[model samples]
Target: MSNNHLTREELQDYVQHVFGASYLITQSARIHGGAQKVIYKIDCTNGFTCMLYVWDISSNYFQEEILNEPTFHSSYGSELFSLNTRFLAQHGIRTPILYDLNNDRDRHSYDFALVEYVDGQKAEAYFQHKNHKDRDELFQRIRDMLSNMHGIQRNVYGNANDNSKKAGPCYQVQRLDAETALSYASKHMKDIRKNDKRLLEKLCELEAAIQPRDLYNFIHGELGPDHIWIDHAMQPCLIDIEGAGFFDLEHEHSFLEFRFGDFYHYLKNNDLDPERMTFYRFCHHLSLISGGLKLLHRQFPDQQFARGLAEYHARCVVQMLS
Candidate 1:
């Protein structure tokens, strides 16, 4: 029983209660990835397998006020683990099937989400073993999946949150245009790096040059190798749908470019504006730097690795601006 959250006994009891009295716990293993959440794979005596995601609400990364919101407990909270999964699944995207969600903080300080266990290697590892032709096919499939999600249009632009009985797009922060988004990023950078006026000015110049586009589409906020999983059949399935929402299509494309440099030329030739992509890339870099610094300040103030990441992302932002 680790002190991080629920004890092994408590978890087993919850699983048994959810699965039924006939089901017995067979195995449990911790799966690692994101820093803010803890995931466990649980197998039952009846041969049923499921994933349990425990959110660490005590972490400094989470906003307590947001978590405390009534809607947060509804479609917007741990339910998002299920909501987003179903939303993507409807678009022909492969994602885990959510079984249940428990947000009884009084019973357990952390929130828990039970989902189907996916069997496959992460896309990052799978790609290392593939040939060029195979990798190209996989990339195409990924693009197709992105296009499918983007095809689901909404009139509003913002984060996808629980609206009434269903998940809908809602702007928690207004970013109606390129300039407004850039201004938000600039202010964030200034707040995190108070003494770095030179970098702020450079960011401002980049912001000034951006031409706002009114295009809005559903975007996977964090699309990288880590979140993509490839099954035995070489089919790609996207996971970690937590940060997904309606935003500029260019933002998603730019992130795809930043993470995989090979995509830059392909995107540029396919009608994606070079300057818009660059501006979004800069915004992504700023976000990475800001997030890294926050992690360093709150969770790992004494860890050299956290400090190194913060420095690396800051350097990337500076280089992008230059």
Candidate 2:
């Protein structure tokens, strides 16, 4: 397969293949700010709409070094999304239905999939415009959804695709064991070492203090309000679900706290291990530093936005150290 980006005609052909011979794309709009892949909103001749997900290196923001890192699986691929859709649905969680997936290397250099178009606004935007009472009701539903999702526990932690039978051996070990957590902390620290030695040192101190965990919860590894869609009927629909897995619940909460900011209290679990939260919070910022720097290094379209993200996290790291 040749390394070529999908043109409008190619995309039209793809939609026709999925929607049938007479199908035509009346209009298509590319979605912006997708760091790992290109997405398009396609409008077909008969008012049929769908989403196009194209996974190609050309649209990725991570540098080769970060992309090649075994521990960094930011771009897990279409298979995971398809698997997680069924998994999430089995738990009564909502997600857009996937229509088709294409991995034929001879036809294209990248993997792509067609998904049901969700006619809705992002949960973040939806939350912003809601009245106080409505907002409270929404949060109540969100809390329930998250509680149910995280309630699904496993003895061993890994990707959702991992076989349960094979997880028995690692049941005794925490996914975020001190050695593993500290090693990742140190690697991420390198990106910020020149900016703040004090924060770097504090990261080591924090990592050394992490408490061991025994149980793992199913989690959306990188959940943010933006990753949730509020359907026209006002139900929350999860997206960007390729990273769904079983891990320390604190890892998921840490990401929610940052992404949801002040709004996190409505969804926070009262029983979280405080020590795990603290360590995870620190690691979360470190990962942001690594991600932001990687975006900048790769010359992401919005250099200022990427730089600002890194700077904000750098400050958060300092505040945590203090």
Q: What lDDT does the true structure give each of the candidates?
A: 0.63, 0.74
Model 1 segments more than 4 A misplaced: 1-4, 60-76, 104-106, 161-195, 263-269, 299-308
Which window of ten consecutive residues has the lowest lDDT sum in model 1? Answer: 169-178
Name the lDDT value of residue 317 in candidate 1: 69
Best by TM-score: 2
Tens digit of lDDT per residue, candidate 1, span 1-322?
2334667787787887887887677777776545556778888888888888877656435354246534331212465666677778777878777777888777867688788787777766744554878877876777677678877766556556532322432221211222333333355455335535555565556555666554568877778777778877878787777767766676778777766665544333265666556666766665566555556656753556656655666677666544
Per-residue C-alpha lDDT of model 2 across residues 176-203, encoded as one tens digit per residue: 3323333443455553444455655665
Count of backbone collisions within predicted model 2: 0
TM-score of each: 0.77, 0.86
